[model samples]
Target: MKKETIKAGQITIDFLLEAADTNGAAAMFEFTVPAGAKTPLPHYHEHYDETIYGLSGVLTFTVDGKITDINPGETCFIPRGVVHGFDNLKQNDAKGLTIITPALLGPVFFREVADIVNQPGTPDLKKLGMVMAKHGLVPVVPKR
Candidate 1:
């Protein structure tokens, strides 16, 4: 088991534990989003399920065209193939935890995002899309 604390985008991601290297089934993370931080574009994986538990503040999630605001102690689940995304909607930091099942790709994907966000210059969205696609993640275009 390995534990790591890293910053990704505007969030601090703490890899509370990982089962990818051994069990190949699950991974857990403690995530914190600074005020005003927005998550990545809405996307879905073909074979992984994700669950988020809100620890504090408000989490605004846009899932399958519906918007819901989850408060502290609330939890939301995104089944495989369902498009979902979230943002920290409070004036102060928002803290949460995420658990992913069938952990094959999700952990690697998060690590990549952290790497990209730390690189200088504006990120190339198209390239990022391609990277995401390669990992079975499909990015959805949000409604205008």
Candidate 2:
């Protein structure tokens, strides 16, 4: 399988291992979240669990209404169906490695997101939601 490096909006993801390379056991990737970058919205994955290990700097995560800071050597586990989002609130960039069990998500999802978000005009949130839904990621919609 080809290992791909993708720039998805404010983050860069380097795919290390994919489903085809691991017999569908897991998909692993390294990611860099630039300073001041935040996830567009909290989302939940219904088909897989994700574990993130911090490599450098600090990354702040909000999971199910709780906030946690992951520094170098620290880890965070987001279980399937749990709403979670992350951001780099520090002055420096944050690096992390993530593994998704069952290998349900891959580069394609990020690539699609990059395409939408990188467009010249404002991204269509509805279209973005559709892409996320296609990959089993359901973005949380804010209630009035």
Candidate 3:
């Protein structure tokens, strides 16, 4: 019944509502990724599917080993267990909305990442990986 706004990483996250907390699902969100900002390294969830709709500017998404450019009105679906990550590649910030199905632990994941980003000192990649693992997330290693 209430909305929340969080400034994390290079994005200002506006959470609309908790769609299904008991089921770990959330509704739409206004995600603003600042220019030149990149999301966390490619990662995947074993039980969640993420769909992204770009609202403004351009978003570069790297899924598996291929890269795709998404602009306003564009959409991309990332199936469960697929490695995916994105970044704002334009001079202006990119705005988008992402929906995760079966929610899984996505909300928890976002909060954790926000905490790490706000912590002092450079983020420790290894520790972050551990934190992600606790929520069934696995980082995708680039192909050789």
TM-scores, each model vs. reference: 0.88, 0.95, 0.85
Best-matching candidate per lDDT: 2
lDDT of 2 by residue, 17-117 (tens): 98989899999999999999856788899999999999999999898989999999999999999999998999999999999999989999999999999
Q: By TM-score, is 1 or 2 better?
A: 2
Relative to the unseen true structure, what is the C-alpha lDDT of residue 95 in candidate 1, on a scale of 0 to 100? 84
lDDT of 1 by residue, 32-100 (tens): 888898578898988888888888888888888789887889988989999898887779888888888
List candidate 3 stretches off by more than 4 Å: 19-26
Which candidate number maximizes TM-score? 2
Question: Can you write out model 3's per-residue Cα lDDT over 83-126, one digit (the tens) per residue?
Answer: 89888877998888887676565455567778887777787788
- The per-prediction CA RMSD against the true structure, in angstroms, equals 2.0, 1.6, 2.3
Candidate 3 C-alpha RMSD relative to the actual structure: 2.3
lDDT of all predictions, in order shown? 0.80, 0.92, 0.77
Off by over 4 Å in 2: none
Order the candidates by TM-score, highest first.
2, 1, 3
